[model samples]
Target: MTSDTEEQEDELLALHSIFGSDEFVRDESKSAGELRVCVELPAAFMVALTEGETLSQYEISFLPPLLLTFELPEDYPSSSPPSFTLTCSWLTHTQLSALSAQLTDLYQATGGAVVLFSWAQFLKEDALRFLDIDTLLELPSGEHSTQNCSQDSLDVALSEAKNNKHTPATGPTDIQSLDLSALSLEAEQTLQTSEIKADYQDDQSKQISKEDFLNEGSVLLPSSSSGPLDESEQGAASLPRESPPNEDQRLSGRSLTPSQALLSQILIYDAAQQQKQFATTVFDCGVCFMGLLGMDCVQLLCGHIFCRTCLSQFCKLQITEGNVQGVTCPDADCDAAPTPAQVRSLVGEELFSRYDRLLLQKTLDCMPDVVYCPRHSCGSAVIWDKSSTAAMCTVCAFAFCVTCKKTYHGTEACQKKKKKIMTENDAEQPTAAVPRSQEGMKALWDDYVSGSKQRKRLLESIYGRRSLQNGLVECLSEEWVATNSENCPYCYSSIQKDGGCNVMRCYWCKRLFCWSCFAKLPSQGYLDHFDNGTCNHFGSDFFPAT
Candidate 1:
């Protein structure tokens, strides 16, 4: 037969294999071998309780650690069983008693076989199911109160078992009532060492028996009595108890209330339908023209779908290059653009902020009545009334003209000020002595040329130099019209008598007019006007020589 020491080593090795060495704590100061351990309930059982419900922090706090203290007897496994005590903060006294009874029964059923490992495994894996703890609220109170299981209960039993030197391990007796003292010296020294803190104690005032909780006729109370049931707790009672059909067929098929059953069926159908739809779906990306799953593709408002990878890359490229407006549907002919929310979802927060700012700036730039402060130090956008010509910057308090984007001149038009500058420059110019008529004409021409130059410079300062140069080209276009064309008296369109008779028709207004005096002519033609001698220079050049 194996010696007790060798058997103890083998049992400990087995426990290490099952629970890991970190979970097994041996007291170094004790010659009578003793160990303390902590274990978690299995995930398969926890999932059943948590399914279809979002647990709050308070509800999750009730999941306390299971602490066990055990001592090895000197006798062989063939004659004696290990003396053990189980304690938990989240289970009531009756629940703990029931668990102790079940554990004792399990050991006896094995005919005095070594059963500590089996007992730990059962408590870790099957205790929740055995006690029907189907929800978080059904868990025992976790408040500080006298009803909590005292650690002294376990210590007293351990002390008695240690004193009874001849006590046999094999007996039909109540383990809860059996005051066995089999703890080692180290355990006796640390009997009160692992006491639960005051805050960690269960709220015994709200404690309910397991029977009352599981009873169908009893109305379950909230976890606290200080107030009525909250929305979560009220809805929690109606939630269906979901478990895999194969794992526990009876529990899985347990009948739900009418409303709960309908909800369960709806959820099942929606999940199945979505799975079927997605399985059958194939998305062809518009950008890369690659086939992908429905989930891999993003659909724009234009009803065009592209793979998320391609769309995200497209958006990032456009935003990086400051081409935010170009971040639209990739289709060559489509004009649809993604919304701000869509861009945010695709490009992430940092890049989306850039895109949004660029988009807003572009929009403000297009508004005629909106102008950014001309001061480079304070280039904040400012809005003016459409009818007003100036605006005051809200941020910098800088007043500026909306038209010229210069300093604001109240009640004065920017163009009127520019014209006044040109007139003043002309008045200051010195006139050299010359013949009377010739000098007057020469001075007029010189002043006209100087005035044009001054106007060009003023426009250049208001607009950019390049923009003013383009405007000069347009302004010079009027010269061509003045030289080769005469204005239609009716519509004021410059009508060029290009190789046609003096009876000219305005292309814009289509009315007949005399090229000589620019007067509306009879419908008959210029021949009738000449016949009546309405104006001179009929047969010759219609416009008299200037």
Candidate 2:
């Protein structure tokens, strides 16, 4: 014959194999265990707050599970049933008492057989249906001390059913399923402090209301027009009257309602479960097009997934090419960039450092009040001063004028350019000023014109506003003439070629020249220049039509 201990061991082993660690826990030494029974929700059921004037409903796919804790006695299943408690946050005290009675009745119907699994199945699959809650579950307000009442009823009902053999016990009123007495000393102290704070808040709110009422009603009466009131009238008037609490005060001191508290628990549980499912599932990488488990891939902030190897290679290429901006989502339609931490994980510290440096440089280039130190060896960033054109490099201790990019010379015209502080050998060499590239000049001009009023004024203070205006006009004129005409080789004056073949006459000098080569052509045989292969009479090299 099978012993009661053997039957208990076999059932526990089967349960451990069926449920994951998240749902079931067993205490082998005490012959006790706990199971979290997650009731199945229907397709479109809603949960709502019961006391609100406006209906506040939420569509949820899952709720926090009901905790069922049980302990088996020495007697076999043929003699006695397991002692247990069913606890949930969303159910009312009345509902909990009814369910506790039904569970006892279920054990009686089982005829001394093991009824643990049967009760769990009933809670998971048919609890809501049995309670006649088809579409919605309404939660009570904070005014209901439902958990205390439910605890008492549970104790009475279980004690009567077992004939005082054993009584069921409940846990606290949160998502956790541990006895309140088992809480740590620190947690108990925290609870006490929170209660004291709540009481203080209530007292402060009442005092503020009383003071406001007295200020509004205590107006001085003129002795000539009105006689003094009796002592009873003054005493009655001094007593505080009831009124609605201030909106800000009410919100700051108000505790969450029971329905709100339960709703928050349900939402938190649903999100956690969804994340756990996502982590273990398989997904297709968007970049490499490889099917891989989520543990081997990376999910970006934009919700795109790619294998780590592919993302590493992509980021490495971007950093190598100095195209730091391209280190973003590989999806053509999405422009979301990976976070610095994610990028660091993929490309490693070395490449991520390079990416960080280049990104910072690009950002500083866009700011009007930032510039780089002129020393070639130490190209550190320097913050520009609004009051003066001179800036000092914090890294190299080099002070230079911002406008001319040379050593600072206070109130003096800028000198001829010298070689940038490169090697110590080249630092003192006198070098011609390098002309700015077309792109560099355009970027600088854009920064000056499209900058804020303060930035524009700062630039104007350093370089006179009239000088800057003339420089702009000169830049525009040079661009226009360079596009429309050629310059005279001798006088350096612009000469437009309107008509005639390859032969041109400068209006300023009356000198004949080959329009194609701009070579000084002889007045007698100016057409001879085109006869040679060096120049073309009607080739695409002629000035573009206006």
Which candidate wins on TM-score? 2
lDDT of 1 by residue, 365-455 (tens): 6676666666645556778887878799999899888777778888876764445445422433212322135333333232223333433
By summed lDDT, which 10 consecutive residues of candidate 1 come out lowest? 239-248
The candidate scoring highest on lDDT is 2
Give residue 536's error in model 1 in angstroms.
Answer: 85
In lDDT terms, how accurate is model 1?
0.51
Kindly list the per-residue Cα lDDT of model 2 for residues 422-451, writing each as its tens digit: 553332222222125554444445445544
lDDT of 1 at 272: 37
Query: Please, what is the whole-model Cα lDDT of each candidate in the order they appear?
Result: 0.51, 0.60
Candidate 2: the clashing residue pairs are: none
Segments of candidate 2 deviating more than 4 angstroms: 1-10, 38-65, 74-80, 87-102, 108-112, 125-272, 373-546
Cand. 2 TM to true fold: 0.47
